[model samples]
Target: MEELGISLSFSRPRVSNDNAFAESIFSSIFSVREWVDQFIAWYNTEHRHSGIKYVTPNQRHFGLADDICEIRRSTYEEAKRKHPKRWSRHIKSWQQPEIVKINHPRPIKSVEA
Candidate 1:
């Protein structure tokens, strides 16, 4: 970033809080196991970046901030609902042992093998 004149600053390596904002954005984008390029395109055009004061990165770069907050909120909620089981497991596994032990149904052994 410094190379592009976006002066870089960070805390000690082991402490991630200093870069929490960037980390959160990355996690949101990369957590899905589907088309990453589509996600990137959507993230660039739609996701509201909180570090940029709830304005989308695209909006901030283009000076266009309208109902980005609502759009982002709705989109995030839609994504969560679209993958309820995965999202629920992600949020609950750390706190619920039964949830963690819910084994995914295994595929049958191949007869040819």
Candidate 2:
């Protein structure tokens, strides 16, 4: 590690991009670790992930995501109602699934009789 100048950092689960970005910023291993820590904190608490209906991971973890999504859904519905011409189609869904998986399984096509 010392000869090659390689630094090891533990980043957030399922987030590969953070490790490389932090590593490229500084040469010091401690710097990488520190930055990764800060990034993880901010990512979980402040970042609104679209995967989770634009709610922070902390909000989803604490069971506040449902209410937040409900508010968004209501607001969007109201806006569409007032301005029908603005949107040509349906509004985006704020509904969060029971399991937030990166790869959802393809629905099996049944053979119709």
Judged by TM-score, which candidate is best? 2
**Superposition TM-score, candidate 1 onto the true structure:** 0.27
Error of 2 at 113 (Å): 23
lDDT by residue (tens digit), candidate 2, 9-110: 455544557667656666577887999999999999999998899999999999999999999999999999999999999998989878877688889999
lDDT of the candidates, in the order given = 0.58, 0.86
Instruction: Give me the runs in candidate 2 sitting further than 4 Å from their true place.
Output: 1-27, 102-113
Q: Estimate the Cα RMSD of every predicted model relative to the unseen true structure.
A: 21.3, 12.8
**TM-score for candidate 2:** 0.63
Instruction: Give the candidate number with the greatest lDDT.
Output: 2
